[model samples]
Target: MKTETQTTGEQKGFYKLSSLQRIGFGSGDLAQNLIYQTVSMYLLIFYTNVFGISATAAGIMFLVVRVIDVIWDPIVGAFVDKKNPKMGKYRSYLILGGIPLTGFAILCFWNGFSGSLLYAYITYVGLSMIYTLINVPYGALNASLTRDTDEVTKLTSTRMFMANMGGLAVGYGVPILVQYLSPNGKINSPESAQAWFITMTLYAIAGLLLLVFCYTQTKERVVMDVKETENVKVSDLWTAFKHNGPLRILAFFFITAFAMMAIGNAAGSYYMIYNVQAPEMLPYFMALGSLPAFIFMPLVPAIKRAIGKKQLFYVFLTIAILGMIMLYIISVIPALRSQVWLVLVAQFIKSTGIIVATGYMWALVPEVISYGEHATGKRISGIVNALTGIFYKAGMALGGVVPGLVLAYVGFDKDNTITQSAFAEQGILWLVVVIPAILLLVAMFIISKYELDDAVIDKINHEIESRHKN
Candidate 1:
């Protein structure tokens, strides 16, 4: 009788997951976005407006945390690759690291020690570090699930869809929930601290539960065996980085893509509240960030097949730039300035491009991982993910630093609360539109350097499997 691995097609190293299995895997990303997206899109605003810190100080703290991540992610990545736990390689972290990750995520938003940079630093740092523990392994988990390129695409599409569902919740639901819960029915004020804390607690708990679901659903089918894993070392991360050309290009792409998303996301609340002068519309505005995912993500497989991957990127990326340009024009025109509908429209256009371009990029990670595996004869998914994590954090560093520094330079007053000065509003505009537009251009260039098309990656996967068969 055949074993389950063979019955499921895993013995050939190209497993096809069930729809339920795919959704379970996707839940991991959804779980992360619920917590991390809350942090990415709202934490800066929370620190400045609610937690009582200057934008400059918050920016510095963000940079410091990323610097720490540069050191921490590699160690976690290398350690994960080297060890195999009884729970499961890679999948075990969904629960093991998730418990603490949820705690710190909730605590990061709490105002028990309000205005204490020391408290902010401690909680935020803990949150970022613990996030890496879960994020790196979760990233590796994608590649471990299957080696079939089409299945990987399907899996990535499902992951982005669910991930954006979490984004929509955080983006739209957080503010609405926070507003409903706040004593004053305001999301970005000192008075809303309790609401922020409570909201985060709920989201974090939900995220932890989803991680458990992901843990139950996932099994690592295409990973290094015992002897190959034993040879894994921290030094191997650097070796892979130097040798893996596609990984290098993809890493740069991650920095640009994430920085663009982070900068725009970080500035969104400020843009809605201050620049647009409509705090009531904040939820709808932020929700647009993820709304495109539901429409466009499902079309990614078809889009990629129709246009080819690189062309799909170029077209969507150009569309994103167009949306940014439209936004800048609307903000500057006196008549359009007050047109909320126009603002929302431009945002939708911009988000559509961004959502498609960036959302589809996750699919490339598996390709680069396979590239490294073909070259080295070892599948160090953990280490590859760690490298990507470090660069991804670097992009986030830019996202965090640029907004705070720009806001500080423009004399943004956390105390003012009602309105920012014209200069500050313009700075917020730059963060929302100009800077992100520039980053997209850079991203287009970097992705052009990516060498692995579908044909190339398919060939690589086939050759590796053939060697195994031999």
Candidate 2:
């Protein structure tokens, strides 16, 4: 068991994170949310409206990109872990990969080659790969920062708080901003591409600036240092996965949680535009989704202290499920067609639960890494982070592919300015409501299987530090 003195030190270190440092550490996530939400929320619409691709073709593209991820993500993970450069093993990638990611992101939103499949494929694929390069290392960078549990929580809360701030920019602000830029007030190809292009360039550039800020304010505290003479192998990945039970649990949780968030977010742009009959209100609706984080985030430590993480996840995930079901019912019933406030309220409720549940889980990565070290006598934070990255990206893939495929199958037309067919509306509802609800239910069950509580993790951390001291 950790002594009060050690725990206090951890708490102090966490509280000691300067605002600049907190913001810097948080910027990696901020950059990711900006780029990712842009892709997830608008890419399909961009394909249909601006580029003249069928919804089905876009959906197929979503799956292809994700399949490509399985091959790309792990390879990036191995290379980074093996090299362990001195400038900062994981943090350096934010600048190294970030430059290209920024350029590719802008290209993705460009409409110069409108209606060209090859153009879309080249930009989107490059953007996705570049994002992977920046993101995997960024995820690993969090664990490298510190090993103190309470400090990790503080770092996570602060990081998530900044991330939600970015979410507000992407989810709430982007639509309104882009529309304002559009000459005709409609976000279709040819006329509107320049507006999107300018907006995304601004976003990408801002994200790179944030990455630089993150690099300056942050320091690597508990990293697994690789000597200059050592070489890392891919087999080490398998060995870590085979032995690290907590890593395994967290990896599955990443898949389910990220997938749920991704699918729900992707479907939301469609739902508000088509079902709710208020495309202009999307930023407000998405803003509400992230707003709850501000209200509930400060309360996480107290909540975790009271209920424990495992129990807290169960409660909040159920709340999310119930909220989704209510939203689905509200969307389907003709009587509630004009109840935009009701939809917003449901979004807030659902978001509150999700914000609390998922936001706190990132704190567990360090805990699992600690557990792996205690169990295996080797501290391989990069490998552990890579394992979790694979599953999380897999979830993100599902989020993209399922909604795109479902909308395509239902005969959604990108070119139409008016309402879609009844079947298409139903598909939109299922994407926003039913499918995401089912995924959230799966998340609740998978979370139930996680065996580490606070006490167990604290013990593991204590053991690892003690052995290192010896």
Candidate 3:
């Protein structure tokens, strides 16, 4: 009689998951985005104007903290792979890491530190590291679910849709809530620190609750055999990176895609507050950034199937580029700058492309996992996710670094309350348009190198399952 690992295998790679299962799984991303998006979009502005930190200091802190992630991600990945905990290898962290992450996330915005940079560092670093603890394993969990490429695509669609819901909440809700909570009705006002704290507290708790919901819903299936598992080392990440071709392409794409999103997201508040001169309309303006995802994401699987993967990326990326260009022209032209309606239209166009392109990238993760397992008999999901996590964070680092550096370079004075100079406004425009557009161009080229189509990944999955049976 053969053992479960070697033969008589009941667990197959492709399992058709139900809609409820898909939605539950997708909620995890939503939970993350709710809190994380707030940080990405507003944290810098919060640091400078509200929390009384300089843009340069915030920039350096962002870079240094992510450098910590560079060191920390591998350790967490290796540890997670080596031990199979009670709740589940991946899902358990949803509770374990998430609780502290919630505490730190709430604390990061508290201003109780009273402008203490040390407190800022401690809380932000804690939040990021704990986030990685959950993020790396959570990413690997997707591959362990099913090998159906279409199902993965659909799952990614649902995931992106839910993630955007979080974005919508942050993008639209945060500023509105902050303004409502603040005594003077100004969100970024230094005296309104309590307002920021209160707003984030509500968002943070909601995120943790959603994480629990995700924990209850997800179940991992197509994982490696227990007997096959071994001691995962830091070097395994390097090995995965060196050997996996699809991983190489996807990692680079993540870098560029996230940089574009980060730079654009970081600039949204600045653009609305300074460049647009309609602080009241900031909510509407920011909301447009994620609003397009809801309408376009549900159609991704159909779109990918209809036009094919590469073409879908090509078309969407081009649309994003066009939207960026349109935005730039509108900003530079004095008459068009005053036209908020025109700016919003261009924002919708750009965001539509960005949402689809970035949202669909999650589906590629499982494909790369299949390719790696096909090439090397070891299904090292943790290592692969750690590698991707590193690159995407690097991309996010670029987003953080660029805006702060730009603000510093342009001599953005947090003291100036009324309006910024022409040069400052121009710098802000570059953040939203020129910088992100250039990143999107790189993203398109990087994705073009991804050769694993759905049929190819499906074949790889089948071969791997057959080998398990034998």
What Cα-based lDDT does every candidate model obtain? 0.92, 0.79, 0.87
Candidate order (TM-score): 1, 3, 2
lDDT of 1 at 424: 92
- Candidate 1 lDDT trough over 10 residues, lowest sum: 1-10
Q: Score candidate 3 by TM-score against the native.
A: 0.97
Give TM-scores for every candidate, taking all chains together and pairing residue i with residue i.
0.98, 0.94, 0.97
Q: On residues 1-470, what C-alpha lDDT tens digit does candidate 1 reach at each position?
A: 00125454354767888999999999999999999899999999999989999999999999999999999999999999988899988999999989999899989999999999999999999999999999999999898887788898899999999999999999999999999999988888999999999999999999999999999999888778777788888888899999999999999999999999999999999999988888899999999999999999999999999989999899999999999999999998868979999999999999999998998888999999988888888888899999999999999999999999999999998987779899999999999999999999999999998878899998999888888767
For every model in order, what is the number of clashing pairs? 0, 1, 0
Task: Name model 3 segments beyond 4 Å from true.
Answer: 1-11
RMSD of 3: 2.3
Off by over 4 Å in 2: 1-16, 188-190, 228-231
lDDT (C-alpha) at residue 274 in model 3: 88
What tens-digit string does per-residue lDDT give for candidate 3 at 177-254?
A: 999999889877787789999999999999999999999999877776555566567788888889998899999999
Better of 1 and 3 by TM-score: 1
The reply for model 1, stretches above 4 Å from the true place, is 1-4, 8-11
Clashing pairs in 2: 50-189
